[model samples]
Target: MYDHRKLGRELNLFDTDPLIGAGLPYWLPDGALIRHILEEYIRSVERQAGYRHVYSPVLGKRELYEISGHWSHYSDDMFPPMDLGNEQVVLRPSLCPHHAVMYRSRSHSYRELPLRMAELGGMYRSELSGVLGGLTRVRAIHLNDAHIFCTLDQVADEAQAALEMIRRAYEALGITPTRYRLSLPGPGGKYVADAEKWQRSTALLTDVLERFGLAFEAAEGEAAFYGPKIDVQVTDGAGRESTLSTIQVDFHQPEQFDLHYIGADGAKHRPVMVHRSIIGSVERAVAHLIEQHGGAFPAWLAPTQLAILPISDAELPNAAALARRCAELGLRAEIISAERGSLGARIREVRQVPYQAVIGAKEAADHYVSLRLRDGRRLDPQPDGDVLARIRAFVDAHGTALWDNAARHCPERKS
Candidate 1:
């Protein structure tokens, strides 16, 4: 069994320090690179899909959450409030209330039917020490969060678009969900007590899923206090099922915030709010990828994409030049110098770079390199420029099959 904790240490992705408190994981350079790539890739996708990214405060006045009802509903799960004597505030557990205030900041007309705001926002939630796991279960979180405030008539269309985004992400990343839970309002008092609003919200979501032909089972009482939701449950390497993605419809927040926009009839009307996360917590997604791929990331997602291995000190100059070229082309490359370790010693199997090029006098002289993939496959000797082009094409395609994508196209796997 491949444990993410062990692999995370081996890869130097992140570590938990006791002084920093439990669930606070620190990122290393290599790990930060991977996180950077993930955010860049996902942010690009969001921008293309008509989302406007915003940076908001992670700390908020206690009154802000109180107005949005989180203070009453989830005050225990939230960090204790800080009293400035004049006023009190606490770390935000979610970005929902802040976004509601943002929407309230602007008075809009019917033309702005659907206003979408997005962010890779940082949030905090208080968790017991015993329950805190790796990055997957943490107090500090960066969420792939977005909110769509739209007209009532726009609900289905907006919901469909959100689900489509989730589908595209999961497909490109090779993630498979074990099941979908239609988390409707439960019998418990945890949910908002507006029976009519609950019925309407649940119906709208049910209709959207049916239209998309999605399969899901209804789980009573699994919804958020404010809304009905679609929870994607993925079975991890350890066979533990957890929800890492969600599409939720909230009628409570907008009503509570008294959010309104002008309607076609020139009258003010409340907008229905849709809250979603294609990838819930960014840290958990990274942790999931670590475990799912066993730290053998896809070439596109790999931090140090290529390793320059010079067989002897004689080829050091050539290796350095190759690494420079890769860096200039926006590719991450590392030159494994002989000063630190042997070529064989540096290639520590799975933890090594996804691609390695062994350079010697002859190959350096020829100005061509034969690439060796992590799967032990050798790409035919090609000019440095040509190899870079091929790697860029794979990255542009969001290649998810890892080294296999290269091996299948190559002549053979090298020992």
Candidate 2:
């Protein structure tokens, strides 16, 4: 396991300063790379699943949460509201309610029953000061949040599709099946009072889990206030359980929000809402990555993929040129050519980088460079073109590790 504080400093990922209040984090350039890369992967997965992406404001009128019952059930976890000329606005604690409003943006029909909406929306919540932790539990979070509007009859199939997606993500992350629990709620639970609806939903989820031959642990009443859900829980290096993903079936929201569409019989029908997150929060996932990989990120996700070290100042120009070519190939590159340190010390610093390109007089004479691997293997780099191709292929191999487990398993193939 990695010490988050030490790794954060070593990599310059983030820092907690007196000016940056507790529960709030400031991402450095390196940290932003991880964040943005994660968002891109989530977007790709959503697009593959036929989800229409949407953006919602960071704050909304107080009534939005109130209508979604967040005001009553989760008000304590919310940032206080601001009073603006008799209008009350609050930082959004969740994106589900906003997505609910979007479902009503246009009149929909049975033909559009399963309308999947996805977003990587930023959100804020006010957790107790004592409960806050770096990345794992932060006040600001970006969620791979999504909601699927399906007819009552389509709920089972949609939820199954979501489960499959979740499974694929976990597997790709090298998360062993035993590390997570796919939990569902039971009938007559505190979440919903409708016995028939609860029974049907629970049974549908059970069948899906069994059909996929996926193992899950069912919690009799571990669900959201308005619905039943399947959660992906990971046991941290400290053996503490944390939720990495969630898939909830909301039976009450459609009625509460008055969401409707024309049925086959031309009658009004309510659409079931499936709320899900492949990686519950980007912050938490990064925290997990740190601990899981022990701060030695895989080649693809490393902030600085290759650090170029020119042994002599005379080779600086050549090293710089090679760095530029690597950058053009989409590989993050760093060059160090100062004589303040010995060659051994310079090479030792190679540990800070997952890959290294070493330039020296001998290499320049031979028209080759020394390539250092994370595992201590050294290969002489060939021509610039060959080096670029090798680096590209190495990146391609490591890029798979950067994906959500699901997409990693069922990689997107070109049509």
TM-score of each: 0.94, 0.89
Give the alpha carbon lDDT tens digit for every residue of 1-415 in model 1: 5677788988899998899999999999889988989898889999999999999999999999998889887888999999987999899999999999999998988798799999999999999999899888899999999999998899999999988988888877767778888997667666678989989999999999899998999998788999899888887778888898999999999999999999879899999999989978889888888888788787788888888888789889999899888888888888887766766687664244677877866678877777787877776766666677777777677867444353434333223
lDDT of 1 at 206: 93
| Model 2, span 1-415: residue lDDT tens | 6767567767788777768788788889999897787678678877998999999999999998888888876788899999988899999998988999989888998998789999999999898889988878888888889999998778778877887777766554445333435454555523445667766666766676677676788776567767667777776677888788887778777877999999889898888888888877888888877777766776767788888888889888888888888878898888866675877787787675777778887766655677776667666455555666766785675343322223212122223
Q: Could you tell me the lDDT of residue 327 within candidate 1?
A: 80
* Model 1, runs deviating above 4 Å: 338-343, 349-352, 402-415
User: Which candidate leads in TM-score?
Assistant: 1
lDDT of 2: 0.76
